[model samples]
Target chain A: GDSVTQKEGLVTLTEGLPVMLNCTYQTIYSNAFLFWYVHYLNESPRLLLKSSTDNKRTEHQGFHATLHKSSSSFHLQKSSAQLSDSALYYCALSDRYGSSGNKLIFGIGTLLSVKP
Target chain B: EAAVTQSPRNKVTVTGGNVTLSCRQTNSHNYMYWYRQDTGHGLRLIHYSYGAGNLQIGDVPDGYKATRTTQEDFFLLLELASPSQTSLYFCASSSNSQNTLYFGAGTRLSVL
Candidate 1:
């Protein structure tokens, strides 16, 4: 079975501070896709960044994540965080070869709180 | 842009009550899914369908039923709603089974 883990339950930081949210996964497939979905207070969850090739960094909206296949980790990072960047972030994995390859396995989301 | 709409932004029901949540996607996607979001649990798939008249069991399918009447419509049914079923439900659609998913605004269900 595939599973995702987000170790940080809450991350509070001041505006302009760097942001890093941890994400890891356990899957049997060698070629798996990792995704970062952002959810605002009242908005629908949307895709932020998706992994294409392993060990390559994917960036969107000032946020970037690098999928490290050797470590099975895809951590999201931002050099500077803004108040508007505060939201719930979910890390998900899709095993392209599994029976339920299309379905994503999500982690316990991390609540990012940015303060001025 | 792909649009996924879920009716009944909020719902309230009692134990042993019946409730149905509706979802519609105008993107003509072949795959639609129902997911529930809970504290400390992220989002768990309740049920999903690859096409009309097709059903696939998800990780948490107990105490719930789902129907896919058309490619654009999918419904989640709870015959005996309980307090444990109280959560934020989101419906999503993807062009393919394995692709970027577009989510709905979500429906908050409170079962007493």
Candidate 2:
């Protein structure tokens, strides 16, 4: 069984400040697909960023995360937080490769609060 | 826009009642999934189907039955629901290794 851990339950930050949410995963698979999904209040969780290549940074919508196989982590980071960035963030994992391996395992969500 | 739509945005039912949650995807994706989200807990996989007439048991399949009747429709059945099953349910679909999941608005179910 694969599991993802998002250590932050709530993160509050002033607008324009940098933001980073920690995510670490434990899985026996070597090529695990890592992802970040964002969910606004009353909305479904939407995919934000994802990467399967180790050490390659993947970025989307002003956020980025890199899969560090050596560290077994995929931490999401942003240089500056925006008011629109306030949402619930989740990290996820999938064992298989390509389109056929679509089963996903998700982590507990992190609630981000961006103060304007 | 890619969309996965779920029916019955909210539901209220008494214990021992029967409930069926429906999901439809327009992206023509091959994989469909059902998950439940609880307070302070991450989304838990309930069940998933790879294609029409195919179903796979997920991490939390207890008290739930799923059917994939066609490429576009997937349903979750809670026969004799209980209080513990009260939670937010979401349906999602993907185009195989796309890494991008299109999710439905979600359904809030309560069992008394």
Candidate 3:
């Protein structure tokens, strides 16, 4: 069984400060893909970033994450947090060729609150 | 942009009522999925389908059944809804098994 873990349920930060949301996963497959989805209020959740290459960084909309296979981690980070960045962040993992098809395992989401 | 549309943005039904959540994707994607979002649980997959007439059980398939009527449509059915089934439901579609998912606005279900 595969699983994803997002240690923080809620993270509050001041505007312009650095932002980091931790995400880790456990899977038996070697070819695993990690994804970050941002859900803003009153809108559908959209893909923010994704990576399958170990140690390579994937970024989108000022957010960046590097998939670290050695540590089984793919943490979302931003140099400066913005008020508009306040949203629910979800980390997901998928074993592209799993026996059960393309099933994605998701972690408990982290709600990022940026205070002005 | 990919479009995944879900009907009845909000729904309310009795505990023993039958409910069907509809989803239609215009992206022509081959993969469609149904997931429920709840506090502390993030998003749990209820079911998914790779194509028309295909269905796959997901991580949390209990009390739920899904059908893929066409390449662009998928439906989730809760034959006997319960209070525990109350949550925000999202329908998504992807071009392939290993591609990005386009999500619908979501359906808020309340079982009373």
The residue pairs in collision within model 3 are: none
On lDDT, the stronger of 1 and 2 is 1
The TM-score measured for candidate 2 stands at 0.96
Q: Give each model a TM-score.
A: 0.97, 0.96, 0.97
| Deviating ranges (above 4 Å) for candidate 1 | A97-101
Error (Å) of candidate 1 at residue B1 is: 0.4
Location of the lowest summed lDDT over 10 successive residues in candidate 2 chain A: A95-104
lDDT of 3 by residue, A13-108 (tens): 999999999999999989998999999999999999899999998888999999999999999999999999999999999888423356778899
Q: What is the DockQ of the complex in model 1?
A: 0.60
By summed lDDT, the worst window of 10 consecutive residues in model 2 chain B runs over B93-102
State, as a TM-score between 0 and 1, how close model 1 is to the true structure. Answer: 0.97
The residue pairs in collision within model 1 are none
iRMS for all predictions? Answer: 3.0, 1.6, 2.8
Off by over 4 Å in 3: A97-100
**Retained true contacts (fraction), each candidate:** 0.63, 0.79, 0.54
Q: Quality of candidate 1's docking, in CAPRI categories?
A: medium
The lDDT of each candidate is 0.94, 0.92, 0.93
